[model samples]
Target: MHRFLLKLSSCSLRNSKFQRLILPSLNLFASGSPPPPSANPYSADSFRKSRAFSSKSRALGVRCISSEAGREAIEYDVVIIGAGPAGLSAAIRLKQLCQEKNTDLSVCVVEKGAEVGGHIVSGNVFEPLALDELLPHWRQEQAPIEVAASSDKFWFLTKDRAIPLPSPFDNKGNYVISLSQLVRWLGGKAEELGIEIYPGFSASEVLYDASDKVVGIATKEMGISKDGSKKETFQPGVDIKGRVTLFAEGCRGSLSEKIIKKYKLREEVNAQHQTYALGIKEVWEIDESKHNPGEVVHTLGWPLDPKTYGGSFLYHMNDRQVALGLVVALNYKNPFLNPYEEFQKLKHHPAIKSILEGGTVLQYGARTLNEGGFQV
Candidate 1:
């Protein structure tokens, strides 16, 4: 009876044009009770009938079927490998392509982090080109950006004093944002368009076809039970086959590195062609009297030798919290040059101290930034 049920399920799944294609040898199992009618596109009766038809077709040795229009429906159009900015952007682009072509192009996004904001830490300043183009009314909606920077300052600092300089670039159109908030918003937009986002699942391996074409991924399940024990299980990762796969795992992308090495991509590119910086940042609450709501300050030099490339920034974000941080290039020879120490010394600078007087640090963290820009 179990074998017969399995065969019926396979047949029904295969005959339903709305259902995605599955490999003939693949086994299907439900993790929990069947989903509700509203959750699935097909009704239970329709699914059962399709299953019966699929079983009959398979018995007759027919592996493929033609629609009334004599065209074969595709299972998926694209499968993005990561859920970071690049992967999300690619998914959005594929949706646009499907809309333009008036076809069903399924796009799936696979993220290893438990949440969209996991692994993302930064004093992120975005150009707003993509966001503005994609969502024109973002500003009017009062998005949770830290501040729309109106000024940029460069300070060469000593322990107690500093020299401030004007930024070489204009700050007219740029903005500083909470990276977590931005990612959450972007994820929401992707989901609204029917993009499948699988978070908290890490891709264990890449799937390739017999001809060596990249197909999908195998993701490991991750979660903890109510008693705090880890759950052990695995699921078929995002396998939207036939479409382009984008690798956007942020900095130090391990999987992306493997793929680059395997494909021997860009052999001419120097391994040290790029530079990395470790940035330590914190949010502090300042006395309302000392708070400057829209103020932004940047400091460079001193504590850091002139040869070393690094800087510090302090932005008075909304809600009386000040974002203070320092970034130090990793290429420096002195391993003793601690980023946290530099940040502390920077706070003591007379100019900075006056601004942050009596402020209390609330949150502290560190992250890596790609200083080599997009080309690297």
Candidate 2:
């Protein structure tokens, strides 16, 4: 049963600047708050630190201040990191729990982006398995998904020839979607349920109690200069304390990475060395006749050498829009070869070129893909 969200996170140790740097555009769009003493059930032993981070504290100097001036704490029922699919889903589920049990629980979700869904993006041929459970009325509400997958075409390209790949490229029960839009819609639903969502606030530090159990996280201070000097409008981060804290941050999340080490989240596993990849994508307004809404095309073997693993995807959506992207894995051996450069070269291939011969480019971007297959 579509349970990918049930098991996520735990990425590979090897990541790049594109994946690790703290930036809004870098995160995959994604969504909570706190409760009382009786709700606090976790113990310190639950989150044992590995001495990798001394004193059970993260080196991250980020701290949270109270809603008042005397360094008070803003308590909540739960705290969620990231506004991506997993995080948002968790928030919605918690609200559902509250509704079913007829209780009022404070849930807060902190996102580093300026707005909900602003940071999230994906190639996103979305399968609505989880969404069906989270928001069954999505169809009645008109979520921003319009193009259902109509047909799937796979091609293997040689120097100048285009060869069709075999079966398994199916288009049933999936839709090409703007993941950003989907998150926005989910954010709206969360707000409707009285969930507190604070965008533009990044959880820079994990907060631990006397026994070192993670209680919550600290939001980053604003108005700090690049040189570490406090700007005139300096504002210390607010410490959002909660009974439980969930980190659904995207791949290579610095905070998640730290928590994993502090608690040895992956110590027992003989896995997690990930193969990274760079994805470059663009949205175009293709010719009316060529725009077959729901038609999806994928290509392999031409833009990249056989030794290097990479491929391309093109999905036709509503309004004559076509979203296309290229992925180049990081294990490739050539230092001189650039993923973006290769993606640009891929567009010249006859197979891909014909589709965009007369199309007008509307938008495009690059993102890092951390394919650290999920762990149970």
Quantify all predictions' global Cα lDDT against the true fold: 0.58, 0.68
Model 2 lDDT per residue over 207-313, tens place: 88889999888777666899999877566666777888989887678899898889777766745666677778888888898889998788888779889988888
Worst 10 residues of 2 by lDDT: 43-52
Pairs that collide in candidate 1 are: 11-51, 11-55, 12-50, 12-51
Candidate 1 wrong stretches, greater than 4 Å: 1-76, 140-142, 221-242, 268-272, 373-376
Backbone collision count in every prediction?
4, 22
TM for candidate 1 is 0.72
- Candidate 1 weakest ten by summed lDDT: 1-10
